[model samples]
Target: MAVPGAFVSSILLLLASAAVAEIQFSEIRSDDRPIIPLDDFGFTHRGWLELNVSGIALSKAGLELGNLGFFLCTRDSWLNVLKELEEEDITCALQSSHVKHVFTFEKLGQRTSFDVEFDQEDANQYTLIFANCLQQQLRVSMDVRSAMYNLDGKSGRRDYLSAGKTILPRVYYLFSLIYFVLAGLWVYVLYKKRLTVFKIHFFMLAVLIMKGLNLLCEAEDKSYIKRTGSAHGWDVLFYIFSFLKGITLFTLIVLIGTGWSFLKPYLQDKEKKVLMIVIPLQVVANIAQVVVDETGPYGQDWVTWKQVFLLVDVVCCCAVLFPIVWSIKNLREAARTDGKAAVNLMKLTLFRQYYIVVICYIYFTRVVVYALETITSYKYLWTSVVAAELATLAFYAFTGYKFRPEAHNPYFAIDDEEEEAAAEALKLEDEFEL
Candidate 1:
């Protein structure tokens, strides 16, 4: 009875082993047969299969099936998956089979899932429907988490290149180049003429050159972004350039204000002193702004400050116009009293200068308008800015040439006849006094 019982137990054990083996083989066959249904986020898919599994034998196929599925899935969603994976420095091995596409995802808690689907569209084209499903799942998860964590402080946050990376830097670079070149030419002319105005002109030129350099740096940064597919290193350079640009703009305002005061005889002493103080204060404020901007709530978006200062500049320019208008009026009155052709001619020249100032005022008004529009995120306004700036530069250059003493007299030497006549006039005046 004991022998019979032992033999029966051995037979049962053999039968159990065979059953297990058959089950394992069935699972392997199921994994090898690749027709996956994919559904996610308003999208559904059918017909995707795995290829190149000939090396994966039936015995060990179950253990390798999950990994193979993941590899295939990742291959299907390669573009989107690559972006996230590269950010985390994760890499996966992949081989594409013409039969089907694979989708894979690594989830929380070290869990991974993947699916394979066959291609119905084209034999060569295998779509990764599983990747789309995974992407939708991630999106939904993120949305739910975002809703839970939604707070006022975290609202409206954005990245650096949100304003469209390529265009702004390019526009700035081109405009800055043009501005610097024009300013440099103006400075050169002032220097050659031995004009006392050279000091202010040089300062303005330096400011424009610095602005140009900043734009060049920005362009280089954007180029780096295009090359590397990243904008990680732009912030430091951006902040440095921002601070410098503010300082330069402040200096420009001061230099122009002071030069205008020197050229205009009618400005009150108090006004002149106030302008001097304002210029330095603005410079200091701009320096402080750099620090404040870095730590402040507004952060790098403080480009709006450019518009603010430009508005102030427009106001100051308008104030300048008041004095110019008054001077022109006074000149006209004086011309009526003097009635001399030379005096009238001088008044006409001065009138021409006033007209030039008017043109500049219009140009600046347009600039302010465009600047405000830009601050408000109107990109097309820059075209107006460029046009107005070019016009202003052209008019300024023309006026500078027109008013130049050398333009009227190339040699700039007093004529012998005029010197003799002046000597005779002086002799006559002395005789009359005697």
Candidate 2:
């Protein structure tokens, strides 16, 4: 063995050449870069590319590949990839229990390759080895780009929401703007009418306008967090608007559902009491949702309290059913006696039923879609919700406009007659006392 010094030197030289030959480095130093659009043209071209890239190379280069695509998560390349993999709890399966401190290297140009063969047949073993080599900053001569060329599929298509960006429909925002204008006009009309019956109509229109504004804000900016790096304020406003809309709907339902002359005073008091209790509870629940669930920086758990508020809202809605039944019974009794009161009651009842029918349609559609994933895309679901809301509001506004109180044909003419009768009864009681 001592007599083979020349042979030993030759063997060392051969090993060095083989190590250098494994990777070929080439660099093109011209500015003629390819312009890639964000969409696919045909089968030949694509917007994204995917290949089984080495994670070690990605860590060293300060890039990471996730379902969301490539991200330069941090300036520290090696730390960034490790952190990302650790977050997924995948880095603990490395072949080496600890990364080796001493690692070989060669300084070459770009286009690095790992032509070295491995005995491990498991593909994940190779990934672990690459991760270890990267952690040690070993012989990665040039930038090793193991990232797969992928078609950055930005389509929001999935059974459940996936990491993707979706283009929002602008038409919904335009329609929401129109809805806002119409709601505002109806509110003005209600103000001009100056009748107690139309006050509920005014409140309902106001809530609809707020909901439209919330939709418009979401359309303007789809980001959960804002450009200012702050939590979105519009989300809190949305919850408030939604809660108010629900409460106002219940109030209107109770008002129109109880169409009896004898029991009208008691039912009106009950509506006021319901508002007094429900409004505060709704406000508090919405505030809790905003602080803890919606735009909160902490645990964004919406399921627990979301169901609670929804249950409260549903109960309030269902409570109106009894009033509606009683009102129908009262109307049938009144029809046998007072023709005019019964006619007005029937008209109001029809309007209320129409409103409830439209609301029920929307509620049922949303519940079904959300529960069973009937609609594949959440973006489309949002659009449908806005469309439903706008359509319902338009129909309600049309009905109110058509049957608005006027001097020639007042919608609630019985109200004035009833007030006159009450005043006459009071005068007779005073005369009897005298």
Candidate 3:
């Protein structure tokens, strides 16, 4: 929810610096996402905008106005507020403003804490605007540290979370719970076939555990922020787990694509090269995620970091496909050359299916979910999370089912009769060569 890279910007409410953070406007910034977007992310981050004003250096005109020179309004009404401020007869601002908080400049010290509030009637997203309306050479300058806190009222929740993503905490937890169940099931399967289970099976389980932990941490991060404007150490756990999950996930994908631990005990030189490239790319991607989360679009290098994250993500995705392609090609050639064409054909089909599934998983998470987020309403943002998680779960299950260990597992196991036939064929070939 309100974890790193949760929202598109730094408008999230930070409660405690022990783990989570808040949006701090060190200067009166430009119009690059200056209108802070407020949402509950499913009330996982349900909190209010608590603005701490500092360096209250204002002009004579600002002193005359006697207000903090900020405006909070619903997103729809915000544009109207701006349009109204453009006209000379702007007395309507005090009356027409959707957010009624008036911060008087009188007795305003170097640091003043102003808690912002709004009514529950309006069913829409709220935005915080920092501006000096008079527009005469831009007079007011202040350092604002805005923290989000949960309003512990039913009416307040209805008002603050009008965009309706309050279901995200539950959504993540629900999926986390599902993964927990799936993990249990996987363990059972591994135990039942413990004699047949390979090292890759255990690796798959670790990936599942990491993914579960990541989602659980994310849910807690949002929930903690919602309740107290801080995630304590939950945010830290989230970031750590998130990084682990990312790295492990890509590694697993690359390993599985190359059929490592199944068909081969060690990576080939070229396969090792692929891991060398993919792992570092994942690191870059995770670091970019953190930077994007902590710094807003207002930050100077925001665009560059966004580009870095996107580029690295796409490259990593493309990189993982290479091993799968090689595996498929190798299998196709083996099916033609191997005397046991029946067995080789089975392996070939499995690899082709693996390639298709990997492509689909990448497409759904990277491409489909992105389009869903852009096209859907703010209220349905949780759907993107759900869709991505579901696709991942399906992929995981399919991989487990198709590759689970067994004596007669067509993928890796050959019948005794086929083995005998293959031996005879090899004997004949050797005799002919001699």
Candidate topping TM-score: 3
Using all chains and alpha carbons, the TM-scores for the candidates as numbered come to 0.40, 0.47, 0.73
With a 3 Å backbone cut-off (N, CA, C), the pairs that clash in candidate 3 are 13-148, 15-229, 42-165, 42-166, 44-222, 47-149, 48-149
lDDT of each: 0.38, 0.38, 0.63
Residues 204-242, candidate 1, lDDT per residue (tens digit)?
556666666666676666544433324356646765775
Off by over 4 Å in 3: 1-49, 57-69, 72-121, 131-141, 147-162, 411-434
Best by lDDT: 3
Candidate 1 residue 304 Cα shift, in angstroms, is 11
Q: Which is the winner by TM-score between candidate 2 and candidate 3?
A: 3
- Predicted structure 2: lDDT: 0.38
lDDT (C-alpha) at residue 125 in model 3? 40
lDDT of 2 by residue, 1-434 (tens): 01123322222222111010101112212111111001110110221112222322322444221111111111122233344455664442132223221112232124233332212111110111111223233222122221111122364211111112122325447756877887777666666765544444555566567657666665544433212212246545656566666566555555655543323445556645655665666676566555433321111132345445556655555555555555555544554456455354545456456556645644654464344332333223344444455555655565455445444443354576764553444334321110
Ranking by TM-score: 3, 2, 1
* Candidate 3: count of backbone clashes, pairs at least 3 residues apart or interchain: 7
Per-residue lDDT for 224 in model 3? Answer: 66
